[model samples]
Target: MLEKVRYEGAYPTREKADEAVRLVLSGLGRQLTGDERVDLAARLPWEAARGLTAQIPDTRQLTGWAFVKDLAARTNASLATTRWDTGSVFAAVAAHAGPDLLTRILHQLPTGYALLFGRAELTQAA
Candidate 1:
């Protein structure tokens, strides 16, 4: 999964990819409720799941832009890079978790989050 993130994210090295994944997961973990976090963790690879389940700040339901902004702050990366990294990491997540789980995850997040997951942007009605 890290390899896939590295390749898909076009990171120069595994360490960079690892950092991106950690940042994204850690930030995302902070955004998800306990049950949602556990469900997401169950769908990830072991190491990645550990990251997702790690103890951190209390969960807060952030909007999509807030999600990226939080990730950028955690990673000290530009928003554009963070967005790309997010998409890459989430693509790997979606591939591993499959459609049903992915849909459940998406439903938990704000509308625009689907784009980061490599899915079409959710309409306002969604």
Candidate 2:
């Protein structure tokens, strides 16, 4: 799945793909509550689940922009690249975790995060 996402993202190597997935998961881990994180991890593939469940600092809710900024800082990638990387990684996540879990995740996050997960644009009322 990661390899497929890597190809979709046109990333040059598996290591780069792995790093993107790690960066996204690390940032996501910090945004989710413990239970939400565990739920998400359970829905992911083993390696991806391990990445999500790895020991890390406490989580705090962050807006979508903050999520992207955090990932950029962690990966030392430009914000534009971070956006693309996030989309790629999340596409894989959406495919693996399926719609029900994805919807739950979107509800847990602030509004703008849906776009990163490749969901339809959210209206103000959403």
Candidate 3:
């Protein structure tokens, strides 16, 4: 996981990549619930899974912008950097989740999550 994050984020050190992975996963944990969450945790390595399972989750779900804003505040990082970290970490995660599970996860979250996971959000013309 750290390797993927490091490669995707171009982090200078393993620690930096690890931090990004943990922060992104923890934020996502707050947003994911039910069987999809459990299934994802099961799919990941134990340490990564713990990051996803550890959060208690907020009662109200946050939009993707809000999620990034919250993470930026928590890390004292700039929004651009936080957004990059989220994208890098989620790119790794989306690879792990594959198309099907990722589709389920994106469905559960609010708008903008698909792009966060490195997938486009498409709408059918009416």
Give the candidate number with the greatest TM-score: 3
Model 1: per-residue Cα lDDT over 17-100, one tens digit each = 998888888777776665666777887889999888785746457887888988788767799999998888988988887888
Per-residue lDDT of candidate 2, residues 4-111 (tens digit): 779878999999998888888877776766466677788888888887777474546778878898888876889999999889998998887788888878888876
Clashing pairs in 1: none
Global lDDT scores for all candidate models: 0.82, 0.81, 0.91
Tens digit per residue, CA lDDT, model 3, 72-102: 9999999999999999999999888888998
After TM-score superposition, the amount by which residue 11's alpha carbon in candidate 2 deviates from its true location, in angstroms, is 0.8
The residue-level lDDT of candidate 2 at 48 comes to 87
- What lDDT would candidate 3 get against the real structure? 0.91
Give candidate 1 misplaced runs (Cα > 4 Å). Answer: 57-59, 124-126
Error of 1 at 119 (Å): 0.7
Q: Once model 2 is optimally superposed onto the true structure by TM-score, how far is the C-alpha of residue 89 displaced, in angstroms?
A: 0.2
The lDDT-based order of candidates, best leading, equals 3, 1, 2
Number of the candidate with higher TM-score, 1 or 3: 3
- Report how far residue 62 has shifted in candidate 2, in Å: 1.2
Clash pairs, candidate 2, are: none
Poorest 10 consecutive residues of model 1 by lDDT? 55-64
